[model samples]
Every structure is written in C-alpha cells, then in structure tokens.
Target: MNKLIGKKKITMENAFYLLKRIGFYKALKNIWNHNFEKSFLNKRFEQMISIEEKKGKEEKNEKLLIDLCECYLSLNNRFSSEILSICVPCLLKVGLKKDETDETQKEVEMTLLALSEIGYWEMKRGLYLNEIEAIIRYHHEHHNLSRLAYQSAWQFLIFRIYKDYSLEDVIVNELHFGREAARELKELRESVDWKRKEERGKEAKEVIVIWRWINAIDNYLTWCALWSEELVGFLGSIVQVFREVKDNHREVIYKCIYSLKNAAESRVIKVEELLKNEAVDVVLEEIHQPKLYDKMTYECLLFFLHISERLKEKEYFESDDKVRKTSKRVIFEKIEEEGYEDIISSFLETFDSLNIKLYPYLSLKISDYFVNV
Candidate 1:
C-alpha cells in the first residue's frame, strides 16, 4: 500500500477509497508496514472523522463510513491522543447505534472493532471517560454488538488505567492486595447492575446483555494481573451461571471462558482457588462439550498458553529455579495434572487451522508456541 502511495500521488479520499477496496485487516497491515510521511493518513483520518460527525448519522452510508472508520483504525495504534479522541463522538455513535439492516449490521460490527482497536492505544488526554463509559452501560449489548462494544470499552479502560498502575501492580491489585480496589470494583459492578433485570427470568436480550457485560468485564480484566476477592467472587458467579448454560446460551459460555482466561493466564488467582471454586474445571468441561463453538474451543487452547506464560513470568512452576523459562514442559505440568493434555492438543490443532483475523498478537503467539511445542 505504501509502495502504491509512494509511486503515485494519492489524495486523502483516494487513500480511503483504496483502503475500502483492500479491506480492514490488510489496511492495518499496510499501515504497520509502511510509514505515511507528512501525516498523510492522519489528515485522511481526520477528514473522514469530520465527515462522519457532520453527516454519518444523518445519512448512514454503510460502505463509506465502515471503510473510513476502519482506515482510521488501521493507523490507530500510532495515532495521537487528539486523533484517537475523535472516536467517541465519531465512531462510537455508529458503533453504539442499533443496526437497521443486515448489511448495515456488519458495518456496525466493523465500526465497533475499529473503536476497540483504537481503544487498545493509550489515551493520554483522558477525555470522554463518561461518553465511553456510557457506551458500555447503554449500548454495549445493543443486540448483537455486545462483544465488540464491550471489548472496545475494555481496551479503553485498560489503556487509561495503565497510566496509574504498573502492569505488575495492576495484577496485584486485582489479586490479594486489593481490598480498597475491590470496593471500587464492586461499585463499578453495581453501576451496571445487570443482574437486577437478569433475575426476573431468561429474556434472551436481557440475558445476553447481562452475560455480555459479565463476559466483557472479565475479558477486559483478563489482561490485568490484578485479582481481588470481589473480582474472584464476580468470576465465580459467572462460573455458576456457566454450569446452567444451554445451546441458546452459547455466547454466555463463550464469555464465561473469556472471563476465566485471565485467571488461567495470570495465575494471580492461584491453582487452589481455581480448583476450590471449580472455575478451571467448569471451563474445561465447557470447552470439551461437543456443542461449544469452534472459536471458543480455539480460545480455550490459546489461554492454556496464557496460563503457562503467566506462571513463567511470575516465576511459578519453575523447575530450573534460576532462569525464567517459558518452556512447554512447565505448561504441560499443569495440563497433565488437570488431565487436559489430549484436549489441549486437539484444540491447539483446531486453533492453528482456523483463519483468525482479530487478536493478531495472540495469533503470532500461537504460531510461535506450536513451532516450539
């Protein structure tokens, strides 16, 4: 893409149009691979955002708007805080809105993905916390848009919180030393209050939204090493909910696994706690269920690595006692103890074969793990 740009004089509109043609994922790769001098992409992104703010809701051009937001996201990782700030008003409006058609719906999905990717970048200005938080509270589970919305919001919060907490401390705060943090988290949990409506009965939309938030919060929390009693208790609640999951409850189970992944990945929650609470066992049972989605199964395998890597990072389960080693043997020790080797092998094979698009970082990690395994 940069080759084309360098060889030809491409206008901002043309660049966006070409990005629209090449697709979102490729556009991201293109931006990552090449440097657009003189803020070429930045100007284009600002222009598209300007247009979206001025006309996006009034006249929703599905193709153009989707491509534009995706183009901005393609360069989002390096985008300035000022540029990233445009997301709430511009992209979130489209992302958070309920879709009017199947075509428009997919575009909306892409828009939320764009927002999420942008959120993955650190927000230095700290603007629009209320607006972005509103996305989670009001629009996160807007029909089928929950995963992307929740993910976007989660990334946003994670990046912002990183400013104040060390990664190690973030993990620590979420774990044993987080009594005050637990209270804050509890209030945050109460703010959503998803269960107030959930206990009424299993209305699918309400159930999905409730579970979606549960799933989203956990997924967001997974990356942090932080584990508090409140957080653990919250996760245990999801595990209980997972035990009763039915076929229509596929998303619920998927989110449940997503929530458990942090515990698995970080090891901050501890093996005894996982067993005592039955979190690990319940997730493993769900993973092996024939009815579980293939994508969920893939993530199950992916998170096994998550668990082992965290142990390696924190110097747990180390046989060498000296150097930090991320060895397969260390991972398998836990896997073997849990009777998970065969299922893990099968799921990793399944995860390897799939054409995954999101979580490129995890995809690369999976490939490296397989090569070394």
Candidate 2:
C-alpha cells in the first residue's frame, strides 16, 4: 500500500476500497484513531519539512510529497488546524515555480492541492481563521502564484470565509483584495476569446478563475459596489459575456443576471448604468425565455423589482422630477413593451412549483408596478 501510494498508483478512494475488500478497513481506522491521538501524522509532516530544510536541496522528493498528501487526505479532521499551520507555510515557501524542473513544479502543484483541500476543510467547519488569513496574505504578497492557486485562494475568500467572517472583516477591511481581484477579472475578460471554442478549451483554467471572481463579486456585491471603482465595468463585462455565451451557457447567464440583480439590490449602481450596459434588456430577455428554471425566473423578477424601486426613489427624490419621471416612464415602457406583464403572469401561475419563498411577493410587486405604470 505504501509503495503504491508513493508511486501514485492508488487514489484515496481506491485505497479504502481495497482495505474493505481485505477486511482491514476497521483495523486501519483503529490505527488512524490511535495516530490522531498521538498527533503522529502531524509529526510526520513536520519531520518531512525539517528534513527538507536540513538537506538544502532545490529538488524535492515528489513521490514522498505525493504520499504525504495522500496521508493528509486520509486523516480525519481532528488535527486539521495543526496540519494546516504546517502545510500553509510549506505551500508558500514552495511558491509555484514557473521556470523550475518538472519534478520541482510537480512538487509545488501537489503541495498546493494538499493545502487547498485542508484550507477548504477548515473553511467549511468555520475553524482556523488565522491560518486562512495567512494563505490570503501569502497570495497577496506573492503575485507570481499560478492561476490554480489564485482560484483556490479567491474561492476560499468568496465562498467559505463568509461562513465565519463578515463582509466587513474580509472585503471591507481588506480593500486591496477587492481591487486586485477586479484587476484580475478585467485582465481575464480581455484575454479570453469568448467566441472561439478552441480558445476557451485552451484557457479552461482561466475561465474557471474568471467565474470564481464573478461569484465573489456576486457574493459581496454591496462591498464591490461601494469599494470597487470597476463595478460598472464589472457589470458591463457580465452583460457582454451573457450576450456572447447566452445560448450554450445558460448557467453563466444565470450567474451574470444574478450579479446584476445583486448590483441593483445594492442600490449603489445607478439604473442608468444598468440601462447603458443593456442589463435591463438582458434580464427581460431571460425572463421571456420559453423555459427557465424557477430560480432563474426568480432572479429575473427580483432584478426588475429592484430596478423599479430605484426608479421610484429617483421619481420621489430627484431635483428634476420631470426628468426622473420621464426616465422612469421610459424604463417602465421598455419593461411593459418587453411583455414583462406576461412574464409576471407566467411566474404567478407556476408559483406553487417554485422553490423560492419570496417568489409570490416579488411577482406581485412587479405586477403592481405594471398596473400603475
């Protein structure tokens, strides 16, 4: 088993399956339980790192590292924090070399994948905020990390950190994180040839990273709106991506519209900005689609609700009531002309089937707007 693990011949799942077939699974679990008590695995990790530092060699033992990663995955979560404390520094020190030997690069990639899994585990349990901070700090300080590493770090921030930390703790306090992420998003948007299938396949890793950033923005829209100078450009990029990939990538369109919906709810982005970016047309077109899932339909409806609320605020508060009213009138006409009434009716008719609890209220709000418009 050790030979196979060191040789990367067996996966964690395969190892477990083999153990069960041989009826050693329970015995191995007992062994692991004992090791967990003694912190044996953690000590092994520390010993490996200590030996590496003492040797002072540029080439890493890739097979040993792969074996260690497998061992890390097999262990329970009891010593996760300790393991992460050891693994995080190792990952940073390795630093994802681009101009290194294949063996060294493989070692770095394996180390990163191991640390990412550990970090994700900690994030899911809402433990080890300090260690999470360390990873984020390392990513910020070391700009030369690979895209896979960047994606993992951002996903931890955008998806998991919010479980324990607030938007203010991470997004607001760490303002540069948002800006750097926006810059990365812009560069990714420009670099991709969205029209070419071959290009997308070639840049699949980057495309995944781009979606992670979009999701981060969607998750923290209020902060992005208040802090990101590129919020308008972010919205424009989403709409543009939606227009380019609307047919084949409905999921991407959903995320884009959801981000726009979040932008509307933030109340930081102007309705005119949305209109200028064709966000209104995008939502209308989605809602008018012949078949949309309930959640997608709900996002489209909520988008209109928020947009109308913004327009209503302008109608009441703006110094030029005539201009505000005319703007609101034109938008309402656009919605009405786009047959939003039918969309609302369709949603109401299928309200019982929708998974969203707020669907009925949202439907009525938009319905009232159309009736009064």
Candidate 3:
C-alpha cells in the first residue's frame, strides 16, 4: 500500500489510499491482547520497516507509520527488546539520510522511546553495563540521532555516558560535549511558545501524529537542560520561557520553575535573578493563597530554595548583593516571624550537602539572628 523511496514523497496504493485510521486508544487496547508474541512482533516490524522504506517518497505514509509504531509500542513488553534493537538503528539509518519525511521523524521518536525503554529495562535487569559502553559509543558516533529522535535521547545518551564513564572522565572528556548538547536543548525551549504552539494545539491539525515527535523533542531538550551546566549561559532565555508560561498557566509555570530550580541545583545554570524576581514572588503568592487543586506550591518552594542555596554557595553572581541580601533577610524573617522552619532549613541543608559556601556576612547575620531569636 506504500511505495516510498529515499527521501521523496509518499505514494499510497488505491487499496490503502482512503484509509480511515483507527484511534490510538483503540489501537492501544488491541495491541495489548496480542501478548507481544514473536510472530506478531516480527510481522509488525517488517511491515513498519517496509512502509518506512516506501514512505520517504510520500508524506502521507508518515502518519500511518507513526500509528503502526505506537500500536507496536502498546503491545506487550515481551518483544520490546528485540524490536527496539532493530528499530533504533533503522530509525537512525532513515533519519540521518537527510530526508524530510515526517514519517522519518516519527520513526525516530519511536526509536528513541524504544531505546529508552530498552535502557530502563536493561538497567533494571542489571545487564546495563555490558551494553552501556557500546551504547555510549554508538550514541557518540551517531550523535546526529539527537535531532531525529525525541529530544529525550540526549538524557538517555547522557545517562548512558555517565554510566560508562567516571565523574572525572566525564569532566575531562565528555563535559564540553555534554554542555554543547545542553545548548541544543535551549534552542528547543525557546521555540515551544512560538506561534506554532497555537497551531499545533489545534485538535483538528493534521500533523497530530507528528506532534508526538515534537513533544518528545521538548521532553528531551528539557532533560538535556536539566542535566548540563551549559544552561547557565542561557539564564535569560530560561527565565523568559518560564515567565511566558507563568503568565498563561500558573500551575504549569510553577512546575517549570521547579524544573529550573532542579536544573540550577544540578549546576545546569546560574539562575539567581529568575528565582529572586517575580517568579519567586509568584510562588510566595501561591503559597499564601494555598490552592488545594494544585499541591505543587511546596515543591516549587523547595526548588526555589534549593537553587537559591546553590547560588549562594557557588557565588556565581556575587555582585548581586541585593538578591543575596534580600534572600537571607526573607528567610530569616520568615523563620523568625511564623516559625516556618523550612525556609532557612532547606537552604542550609542543601547548601551543606552540596558543599556550597554562602556570603560570610550573610551567613553570620543569619546565624546571629537565629542564635538570639
């Protein structure tokens, strides 16, 4: 039904041309009953690859191929390892060929997800180390796969690299490259709310299947941003994206703020201004109002405190005496006035654990105040 060659167009035969595609939910349920048996999994992979080979010639087959991948994913995990092993390389082969088939991107996402699942399963089975070095080498060689698959591949790759290499080795050999990958993530973050977001949000939009690929991109990019220090270079952009989302969706914005906090604490960035500015104020406002529907207020506060503590210790922006002074004053006052112990305690705890040093004056003042009050 599909005739695709290289990176061209999708030509569908009359038999499959006017297809009324089944819904993902229905397909998901249907695949589950198949038990992921060998014959069914092999047949599915063969059909998927056959279609992908023919799909580069036309774009329509892209949607069908993506659907097939999802259906295969929803099937039992029995076939996941083998299916993924074949699919991962196949997707790389197709995606790296300079083709523009939406199907190719779709397949790339399927492959990344499959690999992630495989990696997770392997880790659980404690069989990860045997293949981890090979996986890292493969990822390093095919780093271009970063663009084709879900952005989460970056994290998968980083996790793999971390598993294979020691901390000192990562700091020496892979750190720079890891930071570069994190920069690529920043680009993806900046594009999320572009005008395309609204168009992409439209339910009737035809590229619905391809949209999954986009989401995977976002997740992967966010993961990279979460795991690397290169993010510190884009503090302004991260704040801007957080503000954009915060203005529209408070809850999601808070979560993003927390993510930024975790990333910053991981030494991904130096984001004092972001946490010290209106974003922190927003968190304070939410804390005061106390919405039961969304209980992430405490989590956001913890994230804020963690990053703030990190910055204080690292002294990345020592010149911002105002932010530093204000944060200490706020925490001291909060602890003193309401007996809300978490404010200073969380900061102190994270600071001690990370071995980050705070300003001598600020530290002395807080200690003295606590000693007296």
Give lDDT: candidate 1, residue 183: 35
TM-score per candidate: 0.45, 0.63, 0.47
Per-residue lDDT tens digits for candidate 1, residues 1-373, read: 5545557777556876666545445422223433532466557656766666567456966456555666766554556555566554556666555555776665665565556554345654335454555555554234344333444444444555445445334323422223322333333334443444243332433354445346445544645555455555655566666665533456666777776776665544654455557665676676667665666866666555665454444446523533223344444454566566556555554554554643533543433332123
- Poorest 10 consecutive residues by lDDT, candidate 2: 22-31
Candidate 3: residue 327 lDDT (0-100): 58
**Higher-lDDT candidate among 1 and 2?**
2
Query: For each candidate, how many residue pairs have backbone atoms clashing (under 3 Å)?
Result: 6, 0, 8
lDDT per residue, candidate 2, 242-297, as tens digits? 77767665666777888889877775566667777888888888888888877887
Indicate the worst ten consecutive residues by lDDT in candidate 3. Answer: 14-23
CA RMSD per model (angstroms): 11.8, 8.6, 11.6
Best by lDDT: 2
lDDT of 3 by residue, 190-228 (tens): 445533334343222222222322222233333333344
Largest TM-score belongs to which candidate? 2
